[model samples]
Target: MQASPIYIPSESMDADAYQQPMPQTANTPSLENPEDSVDDSTSRESWRDNKKPRQKALYLDNDSAPEHRLSHTLQLVEELIKEKEILEANKELIRCVALTRIIYGDGHWRLAQSYANLAHGYLTLRGLPAQAAQHAESAKEILLNGLDMSKSDEEKQAILGTLVTLYYTLGAAHLIQNNGRESLHNLQKVEKILEELQTLDGGKAVVLKISEKDLALALGRASVLQNKLNSAASYFEKVIDYVIMTEGDSTPELVTIYQEMAKAEQSRSKHDRAIEHLLQAHSIAIALYNKASVEAAEAGLLLAKAYAVSGNYDDAAEMYFAESLRAYQAALGPDESETLNTLVEYSKWLVQIGRNQEAYKLMNSTCSSHLKTSGDFSETVAEVFHLMGTICLAESKMQKAYKLLKKCLEIQTAVYGSQHKKTRQTQELLNMLQKSPTTSEGNKTR
Candidate 1:
């Protein structure tokens, strides 16, 4: 899923510069629950106020059914989450968990799902991956370890659905740590469960996000696990077709589909198609949202990368890239990992366009400074070192290049093990350095 780095708000970004929207939870308003409906007669604020009081009254009423009270509390939590009242949402979640435990014991399906919801909320909105990971594991444990197997088929299906939700959060949390393989494994488990259900039902009623229309897209996304770029792109196209059919034109939602499709194209080395999709996203965002919007800024960044990769190192491309970088920095600050990722990509562009010293300086000064905090064994740190080493090699600074490449090898070997593709590449690069008579650092040892 890696392409032009997408922003996942870090603690520094979350502090002031970036705000993440709440994720959709299964417990949220669905076709099954009409109580969460809106009335056109009332203002949004009035509706929220009216609904809260009604839910609160039901929640506190001793005569109300326990299940009904719990549902109302969850509904209120959903409202709090949507409004970005995170502290209130978390507090309410705790109450819901406690009540569920008291009523149905610790193994309650509702309790497990609530934990999964909180896990997702923390990871997506609060930029707290460690806490999110903890809750995600807990959700899985309670569901798999605590839940009884002897239950109705419907109950079992619902539980499995909650497990898929939990696995998705776990995958996101793993991605936060840059554990792509681990993230993929968790997401694959989700697809496996969905596939199993489909096999049992002769491919009927495949559980998917929001609606059955999403199942094809979800499976397409899951195809990424098999490294199937064409399959992934085809699935995203289905989603695109659905969007056009329902909305009659591209909207803000279409921007996400375009971006994902572009990512698939980029992964397949189809830079031209990637650029086209990203440009579409940029154009739509500019028209419907604004230039300063995060979506527009990100789309521009992706488009710039696509242009650079396609060897279009023109002034216009540079300006678009620089403009987008500056916008993101303003909105997300210079220290954000997302901003840093863009800076690295821009540095690579500079190198490709015959500005090696400028590229070297940007990476050596800014990227190196922040990258050190990513830990010595971090794969990201290894990649940065590899890039800097390559730049140094190009500049004929063999001694410095040898040292940097050696460090890259060390980190890559430690993190990826010697058998990994990246580790093998690092070794080959080092071997090439060793074979060079011009190699200045002959006796270097790491």
Candidate 2:
């Protein structure tokens, strides 16, 4: 929940860095139509080499029976993810996209939802940045175009809900790109759409019970990006307000809301308030761990951080390490980046607590694994290197430290201009290294 200072080493990193993947929508409410199979072979033949033809009625819902198979596809994706089979989950999402593209042409709401969901799948599972951005953009295009169509209030609300997803997805992508301004723009658009939806016919009653919760999420994220910590806290509080008013305290939704509130309060430096919320989140997670590992891990992480800040370092460290390990195990194998990131964070905490040797070993393993999976200059790779450099410096491995630090600086300079905060920090570190007693008089290598 506490965003790390290890941002991308690029000017755009500030813009794109916060672009965490949007959560996938569940049990997508279908428009009134019967479900049918998408003729994949026919679709491939018909559109294989051809471009999508623009239809005059872009918003027209298919009068033909809608594919009932889609509902099952979503269920399968959820199941796959729950089982920690992310690769399979990703495959299912891609199938959904290919099949949906055939059944619902480009620019259709259903197609857009498919794209949005696919983006989330990529983000949560593989951290496929480019794929995530492409799908998000596709979803945005479809939802924006659909808004002009003649639809009922209910239908319009449904469309808006999808649009919210699209905007948030784009926002997240931009955040990762270090394009903070663009991310903020997309997030504000989501906020605007949600504001309108909330006023429509006594709330558009989104099929996803978490629609407003997501809206609050967008606002909280945007506020954080803008450095409006108090505002972020208020937005997260709104999630609690909306859920308590609608679903009451007993729902799983309350658990999620409380955790988010804890994060927002922590960001705002309200440690006591954050601790209170996290305790509630932890209690719920303990009760519901068998039902949802995702929620359980989330609550555990929040509680861990809260405990750490409250001077319960021993317990906090244990919880942090344990939660990180749990997340790694739930990643359905070693290919998931989010799981790796969690591990990296845990290792950083270990180092902070004077467990330098353990931290070094973990960082070494993490760096090697990241290099093998992520390209040489990936954000994650850069972060791994930076952490390694920090460890080496701690151990006074001057040459090794300089080599790693220089590489980290180079990556940051390349991705985020020399003027960027990350790049600047790396440069400062390099300068300090040059002036160290270990360095020769002619130390101008960096």
Question: Which residue segments of model 2 deviate by more than 4 Å?
Answer: 1-252, 267-269, 282-295, 332-335, 372-376, 417-421, 424-446
Q: Of the candidates shown, which would achieve the greatest TM-score relative to the real structure?
A: 1
Per-residue lDDT of model 2, residues 93-207, tens digit only? 7667765866777667888888777775555465555567777787777776735646777777777766766676677666655566777788788767666666555232454
lDDT of 1 at 422: 88
Q: Candidate 1: what lDDT?
A: 0.66
Local distance difference test values of all predictions, in order: 0.66, 0.63
Per-model TM against the reference = 0.53, 0.44
Candidate 2: clashing residue pairs, number? 28
Q: Mind giving the per-residue lDDT tens digits that candidate 1 earns over 192-252?
A: 7665454332222323222322434454555565577887888778778766866656667
Clashing pairs in 1: none
Write down the worst ten-residue block by lDDT for model 1.
3-12
User: Lowest-scoring 10 consecutive residues by lDDT in candidate 2?
Assistant: 5-14
